[model samples]
Target: MRVLLVEDDQFHASYMEDVLAETLPEVTEIFHAMNGEEAEHEARALTIDAVVMDLRMSRRNGIDAARTLWMERPETRILFWSNYADEAYLRGIATIVPEDSAYGYLLKTAPRDRLKLALRAVLVEGQIMVDREIHRLQRRAASPRNTLDDSEFAVLLDLAIGLQDRIIAERRGMSLRTVQNRLLSLYEKLGVDDEASDAMPLNKRVRALNRALVTRTLNIETLETAQRDFDRWQSTRKRA
Candidate 1:
């Protein structure tokens, strides 16, 4: 089988290549891409059977690349190998993946045997294999009452980045009331209720953002992604 290996670090990529070559006897050709942009190019240029994708890259992130690839070919099988199992990454993956598509998420720190098993499960057996911790997060996110919906999550990101409610409404194409309602839901999901007993009145938005960060729901990478998007939007507005 032909496999696409997408990673930024050359040494790590070489190491993973040796691992795949040694473990998976079915792999005939392993295509290497330094980043997601190159991965996209290789996927288009080659007849890749499956992919072992790294999440964070210099040009484009793995989630964005996987989303595009899956959009073009829903049957694409990919095993996400990353150092992070952040909720933001999971949410990003959950949003784009096709319902029936088989995919896996394994951290880079995993034992070589575990990595081999995950790759075999995703690439050969066509099974879903997510790290146990990430799977727990997925379960929590699946709960409608306790988890933020996509719209709520979007509002939460806006709040985290210090956007006012009016600005968020305008940018998200949501009504001001809708934005406020989403914020309320976000607070409830984040358990940011009633800081009245505190020495000072705390901002619920800030509290919610803090709770999310502490809970690993919002990480630095999440904010960085949002910041990049905000920067792009600002550039477009300036151009206009």
Candidate 2:
């Protein structure tokens, strides 16, 4: 079987190659790509049986790249190897994966045995293998009581990165009122307004962000990715 390993760090890529070589004897050829953009090109140029992709990359994120690949070849198998299990990344993966496709998500900190098992399950046996720690987040994501919808999630990311309501409204192509409504919904879901009788009430926006962070609903990696996206958007706006 031909496998494509997509990771930005060369050391990590080499490590993955070694692991695949040692674990999966059936893997005849292992291809490596530095990032998602290169992964896309390589997959299109060659016949890849399975892909091991990193979640975050400089050129393009793995979720976006996987979507493009699946658009062209829906049968392709994928195993996401990421350092983070952030909600945003999980949500992104859930959004793009085909209904019948076999896929998996494994954290980088997983034991070698678990990693090998996940790789085999998704890449060879065609099964779903999500990390145990991520299962709770997955359950919450599916739950309507506390989970943020796509619109709310987008607005939350914007707010987390210090975007003003007016700026978010303009960037998202929504009215100012719509932005405020989304913020209210976000705060509600995060329980930002639920204060104890003795505790001081913080600013709703700050409290919402704090709660999201405390709950692991929002994280540094998610914020970093959002900042990059925002920066790119701002650059495009400037150019326009």
lDDT over C-alpha atoms for residue 202 of model 2: 71
- Tell me the spans in candidate 2 whose CA falls farther than 4 Å from its real position: 136-145, 149-151, 154-182, 194-240
How high is the CA lDDT of each candidate model?
A: 0.86, 0.87
Given candidate 1, what's the lDDT at residue 155? 90
| Residue-by-residue lDDT tens digits, candidate 2, 156-238 | 98999999999999999999999999999888888876762456757888888998888767766578767977999999999
**TM-scores vs. true structure, each candidate:** 0.78, 0.72
Error of 2 at 152 (Å): 4.0
TM-score of 1: 0.78
Q: What lDDT does candidate 1 reach at residue 149?
A: 78
lDDT of 1 at 198: 65
In candidate 2, which residue pairs get closer than 3 Å at backbone N, Cα or C atoms, i.e. clash? none
Candidate 1 lDDT, 68-133, residue by residue in tens: 789888888999999886788888778788988889998888888888888889998999888886
Per-residue lDDT value at 139 in model 1: 72
Pick out the ten consecutive residues of candidate 2 with the lowest summed lDDT.
193-202
